[model samples]
Target: MNLDFLLCAIRELKRNKRRTLALFAGYAIAVSLLLVITAVTVFSKVHQTAVIGTTGTHFVTWLPSCGDLSSLTEEELAKLALGIIPEKCKQNCENCTGCNKKPKDILNEGFVINTNTTRLLTIDLANEINKLPGVRNASPFLMFRFRDPTDNKLFTVGGLFLGHLAVETNSCGTNEIIEGQYLSENSFNKVLVDDGYALNNGLKVGSKVIIAEEEFEVIGIAATGADPVKAEFYMLFSEAERVINRRIHNPLENEANIILVESVNGTVHGQVMEDVMKLMKNDSILTSGCYYPASKAIGLNEKLLWVFIVVILVSSILMTVKLQLSFVAERQRDVAILKAIGWSNSSVIKQMLSESFIISAIGCGTGVLISGLLLCVVPVEHLLGIEMSIGSPFNALSMVAVVMFSVFSGVFSGLIPVLFVLKKHPLEVLRRC
Candidate 1:
């Protein structure tokens, strides 16, 4: 621990340039590998978590047997269907006497309906979920596989509408409009496409594309690090409904999917999930599920990433131990001579530890710098299979962990040699030399 003793030890190490360099190189390589692996693991987890969080709560889809519909009248059936009915229509229904009367009231009252039977449930929900209390926002969508009428090419597209709750940018967050305005509820003709989809189709803003017998003008583009498929196309909710030709009879009673819910005061998430499940239990016409951002797909990715990082750290430790042992063995004569001259074992240990610390620091610093530069220059989509965004707390923590690991490795390496030297006689070491 003495500065003078440590300096002297360092000087001795410097005198043997080859040995010193070998130890330095070994430490550096180990620390660098460990740091990179840690950073990558942390980054992946943070990125995935952000994607899931910003997208919405995950939910289980329960498709009740189609037979479930046979028992109910159209009015009862509409209540179980997932869709939206305009508020105006709901209030004006006092005059409706039958199924035909209900549709007439809805149309006359200028009500917009969402039918879960169509594929664009997500898109439709996004447009109207904001109107309800305890709702922050929603991403309504429909899942379907469709073919281009012109090319007869089949592709899966998620139909969605631009809503107030679009995903944010550069945060592994929600899918936001990056190039143009999001789909507007007032305008059902405009559409937004994902960046990847647009690239593949040779389309851009203002391009006209036809789907489901309707031509839509691409007005915007969006991106999702988590879902590359989102880039395919986004259209107005109404347009999506028309393409599929499904209608909703009741608004508040039916929903294809519900994502955002206001956090109730003093209510735990488990309680909320249970409540949601209970609410959907009797609605045999629909299915329901819930997702916690921390435990969903993003969380799984994070867990896997840490496993990868641990493997890297273990490998680094093994390599560092091997090299440090070799270095110490080569210096046995020097160590014995120092002990014979009244140098305490503690002093020798301190000097060795200092040398290891310096080497580890240098290695770790260089590795981190290189990693940061690489992250900056490399497009995240290509390197990590997810888009890279800055300012993730998870990523920052990983960097700190890397530095700590490097320091620990150096200290541990130094201890290995000290333990061996402590048990041996200086005379024996000298005689052997």
Candidate 2:
């Protein structure tokens, strides 16, 4: 009996070709829109994660070269002042007593370590940090201000060993590299120039630039926009040591003032940072986990997109309900005749639902096919400025949910009006018609 009713519903739909097509088109459009939006939302989330991972998933630790004067007692200050005061002390030492001594006195007294523009941390310590649990990678970096021997101009150079993906990517990530290639492990005296700096200096790949009286080959150009950790020139760690050592006339071997640490994941970031803190007392740590204050605009836009999706879904369901109500109204005479012929209310309702289900299944299936094609055609990089395929973001579970929701909306829309019409007797329905 149920099979007969279902077949009857199918025949009725086949006879009402125009009405069936109209309902099919409506459902298909709605489901397609939902699917496209769902795909975009998923891509947006992935883009956000990539952005955060690139900029906010690591931290840098560095030891200050000089101790704070405010933290020192008067006795300690008096002893230090008894020797030669550093040239930098003039601006920071208002409360210190007057003292006059030779510049060599301070170096002979061993008051400060590596006073020639370096704070001094060891590469060995960075290696130790890399061994900590949850620490994805730890890289030693030397940031030096090198004077241009030719022009007598000053330029800041950042030196780091290549081959480590995390820190190397953070400094000059693949996306940021505009020309040439990234630095290799053996690339000594070869430098990566910032795009702006390259332009200003008229430098390009294979161009030679003099730094610390040494000529270096520019191997790549990087466009690091608003990145906090950047320098005019980037070179190998050993090369930078030689540059600084040449200027200072003191060997700076296996020395690094900064250590860049990347955690394996967000869940382990805090523990990794804690362990790092315990390892280095009096060291300053800067975390890159929090989004910059300028990203509030992006956050607002994401919220707006979510709200728009909600509005679209609600309006689509409402429109479907309205269409189904009108469809039920127009078919009341037919429904009355079926009831008069001894079709039970349950049977009638089931047949109508079967029609709704068939239409929705076909509509949703068409919609899914169309959406899949659209995803393949669209490039997410063009839309979001992040390099990724549009089709790759749609998780299997998410797509299943979308299809299920769309079908539910269709069936529920049809059921509402069907129930309303079934409330009346066949005589009442006939009288109304």
Candidate 3:
């Protein structure tokens, strides 16, 4: 009996091929749209994390060497007594050689001055910060500006610890190397110069460059454009210490002026900053991250995309339901004739549902194939400005979800109109027809 009903349903659909095709097209469009939106939503989330990583996700905690009032020299102190504000000197001393001379210039001019007690925090403090909750990793970095004796111009150098420099948030890792190679087993006395700096100085791989009165070989050229910890030259942390000791009257040990910190996943910039500030209460700590307007904009766009997906899903379902209602109305006379032939209401309902299931299954199957092909052929980056591809697992899951949802919608739509038509007697339906 079930087999007979199924055969009759197939014949009915075959008789009205145009009507069946129209209904299939509607279901196909809805399923395909859902699949596309889901793919984009997933990609947008992944892109957000990538964008944050490349930008200023990592916060830097640094003690500005000359910013402290006590760090000023006796001469500068005397000038402060004479009403020359020490704060102005600290902020604007880089260009002014007179009363506004900064501590950087003071150090470069008077190399013999001993200030061992100032300008640094121990690496142990960084280790402690690394152990804090929400902190991903912390690495101490040495930064200083040296006035070249040859040109009398100041240039900065950054000292990076080898193992710590390869963290996820660090942009100047091995991947930034465009020429030669990164520091390796025997990289002592070898440095990496920024591409722009190399171009300006006519330096290349194997070129000899003088830093802090010591000659070093350039092993790699890095294209670290506008990086947070940018410098003219980058060398091993130990080598930077050597240069610092050579340039100053007093030698220091295990100290770095800056500590670059990365936060764990899902941690916000404000939360990380608060944690670091609480840990280093008494120290003059300044924390900075890449939390700009653009980051906020990206977050807003994600919310909007989700809202759009919900709206599309609800509207598509409602439209398919309405189409099913109209289709059942046009076939009431046929339903009445089946009842007159002594067909049971339950059997009639099953046949109608069977037809709905077949249409939805074929439509959703075609939609899934179309979506897969579109994703593969389309350049996703052009639409979303992010490069991504659907993995096998996600693709398989997406098809299953679409098919399941289609089946539910098909059954529900068929059930509603079948019950509505079945409520009336067969004689009444026949008389009305």
Candidate 4:
């Protein structure tokens, strides 16, 4: 471990420049690949998870089975019927006197309607929810179900029902206004349609469109590739309310299908989801479903990191074994002399192990630096399908993992050869030399 001994080892390695270069090069390449893989894996997992959480927030919804117009839970039969029961009535023995049967549970009945009654509550509730801890921002939107006048067919479009809330820039991440201008909260009687939807409907910005009975001026064209159908229409909240008729009871209330909440960070998704579910449960609302970015993507990135580690370990071990064996063969005479002179097996092993350690430190350091440079130049999202932002704590952790793996690999590789050399008999080695 002394400097003189290390210098001697270095000098010896330099004598066989080609062999030294080969070993160093092999180690460097392996370390570089390992580092790159680790960094990319970590970056991808963090990025994709964030994307998924954001997407989940943008699409989160809460639906009530018995769609009473109020946020409060209901227990009475008339309230339940008025809330979600269809306009069509049917006779049932449960509701008749002298009938021993109980009424069918509203929870069991699959009844949902798109109503305008909940438009006011949607905005109020969203604001209230946003004020809670871990809440980022929430906006209320209106969904209208009406037959398109031109086609006379049932169609649904999401309208910004009410509130001064604006689609904050980058709110949808990849989805944004691609052409024309986005609708403002103050703007009224104007609509923004998704690009794909506009194309299908043969519509363009500045065109007049009729929904329900109200006409709106097309103000912008937007694109949300994630959902071709859902992204079809974006309008002012006021416009949405007007189109659905502010006077009408929101049919969708008992069917409360829209309420999206975003958490500040992706890592908080689980916590936020739990809180949301708790709120819903306390309110006696049933959460139909929750979506976050694909967990599969994060899992896949982790698996790839494991695969890379295995590959690096296997390749590094093989190379280290080959190099050590070659060293032992070439220096057999020296090793025998040291043993003959009463040098303990431990000392000799240390010298040989030290040599490998020195080479490994250089190789691994070079590799890590190379990997860092590559990470800087590479568009990680393009490579891994997950966005990577620099300066994240996750990135720092990945770097630490890479460095630790490299040092561990070096020590482990060196130990394997040392063990083999220590088992040889001094006399036998000398006789062969």
Candidate 5:
């Protein structure tokens, strides 16, 4: 505690420059590893957060099934599978029970709403759902069914209905636009051709495509992975509603295929969904992960970082312990001299503790400096292929803990050897010296 004791601790370290530098190097390595691991974890989570922020959940009730479709030919039914019902099916099936069935009863192909869940495919219900306490975002999946008037009605499918809400939400939904621009929400008559559909049909961005006998310019061509998108084309909500109303005299503007709701958090998601489900008397279904984007790339990286941190902590402590043991073992005779000169046992312990504290402080400082050098100079993108930000996630409290832990490791490690050596009598220590 006294200045003389502090000076003694400094003198001890100053005498062994090589050992001190070696310990500093080891501590530097440990701290640098810790910093890099932390940076990697922070980067992974941030990257995922960025992606998720741009992404959103997609919720929808099951689409109605094509019932009693024996009226339409297999070719027409095949087209219906892609979100459209043939005009013949639409006209001839005016009294079709399937059309009149509730959205909960409709399960066209894979578009299904479970009987236990409620339907949320209208503007009123969607707005109500959005107003829920836990709901973060609520968007409707607008779908339309209308046959292209220009194409042959007999052989070709009757309708071309689709729900391309991804573009509407501005999230990379089922399709990602590769070549041309995506359909704007407010824009009308702007259609985006599916990559696979366009390639198979020889359609380009500028090509004029026919929908319900109306010509719409192919403003963009979107690339899609799901089979449903690749088979059919998509348009914005306004355009689709306009085309449907103009061609079929149906006021389908307020109708949606399903409502997609996202809650504020994971736990709240279920509650919000439950509240929505309660709104409808019909049967429906609920699903997860679609509401949020998870780090599909490095899902396990965070866990691995924790493991690395623990291993580094243990190894660093052991390394410090070993260095302190050697440093104290070499200075046993000095302890005997201090004790023989009437230095109290407690005083000797305090002085040795000071040395331990100084070593740890210096070692940790060196490690922090080295870590900074590596962070500043080294290329993380080249090595790990993950870019790290200059700013760290560790706050003042966490940074302080890091430094405190380092000093504690050094002081605690040194205390053991010093205490053990001091237990021996001064006469016995002098004889050994």
Candidate 6:
């Protein structure tokens, strides 16, 4: 605990040069492995986020089940329609056929979708959700039934189109256009079909598909390993509005049946999602609403990285403990001599701990420095195949934890063995000598 004890520990360590070097090298190797693996893992996560569209973002869906379309009351239908037809007055009702009832005589029991212009059911709630303070951004996910021009059949349920920021792709990124070019950002009557859909339907770039009676040419085919279940079509934001506008002339064009709320910060995401659910719940138009769970594949490399770190640390601990116990038994005479002198047991223990601490600290520092240099000098991003937009190899928090664990291992390994040796009588310790 005092300067003399510390000096004595340093002198003892220098005397045991071989042991000191071995322990230092082992600890340094363990720390370096931890740092490099951790650095690569962090970069991989960032890259995975880019490759998978929506990444960790969750969504709350409001999918109106049209099976009970007939059950919706006049007021409910009116609200959902968003001014597609006259809310009242049978006199102006275009669907009023063969009924001789006057405008006042006809009862406003329920409303029906014309189903002619657009078969898609889009309920935009972007404006309401966007108002939430926690929400970074909110996009409407609209799905509609579009008739395939060749087959004259409606596309399956997942024919969704979302408002996306850009129409581009990288080698391992989302919105990957494989065969053809993406749709023009400002263009209408253009669609981007998924690879699976195009292949199944014998559709290709430049093939025209009919949605709500209008023909849209397939401009591109996009693929993403993240989204295994492909959509029938992906269209521009402008084109989606264009398609849905005919069926429902809503005041808010951004009204999406399914809302994709993005609040990436994990701490706020739960609260933000709660706020979003509260705001959109018990609505006049919604039949049902629920959170859309995200699906992402866990990378094998990431799993293996942690396993390796654990294995390395465990091995290091076992080796250190074994070596320290052997070394202490060999030095029993020194412990006997120290105890025979005026040195208290606590003072000897403190000196031993200090020696371990210094060794651990130096080794940890050397390893971390080497890891940083390796990360900077080696093209880690290229080798790992994930861009490291972040400058540091090891995250500050992770580095702190690694250092602490390493120091603790050294102290623990030395303490247990030294305590066992000190427990016996000085004469008994010297008996082996």
| Whole-model lDDT, model 4 | 0.55
| lDDT, candidate 5, 4-108, per-residue tens | 889988888788888777766766677667656555555565565544533334344333443456777878655554435577656543322233223221232
Better of 2 and 3 by lDDT: 2
Cα-based lDDT at residue 150, candidate 6: 55
How do all models score by TM-score? Answer: 0.54, 0.66, 0.71, 0.61, 0.70, 0.57
Residues 297-323 of candidate 6 have per-residue lDDT tens digits of: 334444655675566556556655565
Q: TM-score: which candidate is best?
A: 3
Q: What lDDT does each candidate get?
A: 0.52, 0.69, 0.67, 0.55, 0.57, 0.56
lDDT of 5: 0.57
Clashing residue pairs in candidate 2 are none
Better of 5 and 6 by TM-score: 5
Top-scoring candidate (lDDT):
2
Residues 364-418, candidate 4: write the lDDT tens digits. 7887777667766775665665444557322665566665566555655556545
Candidate 5 local Cα displacement, residue 367, angstroms: 0.8
Identify the superior model by lDDT, candidate 2 or candidate 6.
2
Record all residue pairs in model 6 with backbone atoms less than 3 Å apart, i.e. clashing.
Answer: 123-256, 123-257, 124-255, 124-256
True-structure RMSD for candidate 1 = 10.8
Which scores greater on lDDT, model 1 or model 2? 2
Error of 1 at 277 (Å): 5.7
Sort all candidates by TM-score, best to worst. 3, 5, 2, 4, 6, 1
lDDT of 1 by residue, 1-433 (tens): 6788668767887798887777666666566556656666666666666555444342222222223335556776464343333334344333121222122122222121122221112233334434434434334444334556467674433444443332221111234567866655675677777777778889888999876667878887777545312325656545655653422243322223223332221113334435544543422122122335434665567568877767766666666667667777777787888898998887878777776666666666766666566656663445676655655322566567656755676567768766787679999878877
Output the lDDT of residue 268, model 2: 62
Regions more than 4 Å wrong, model 1 = 44-162, 166-274, 277-299, 384-394
| Residue 124 lDDT in candidate 6 | 35
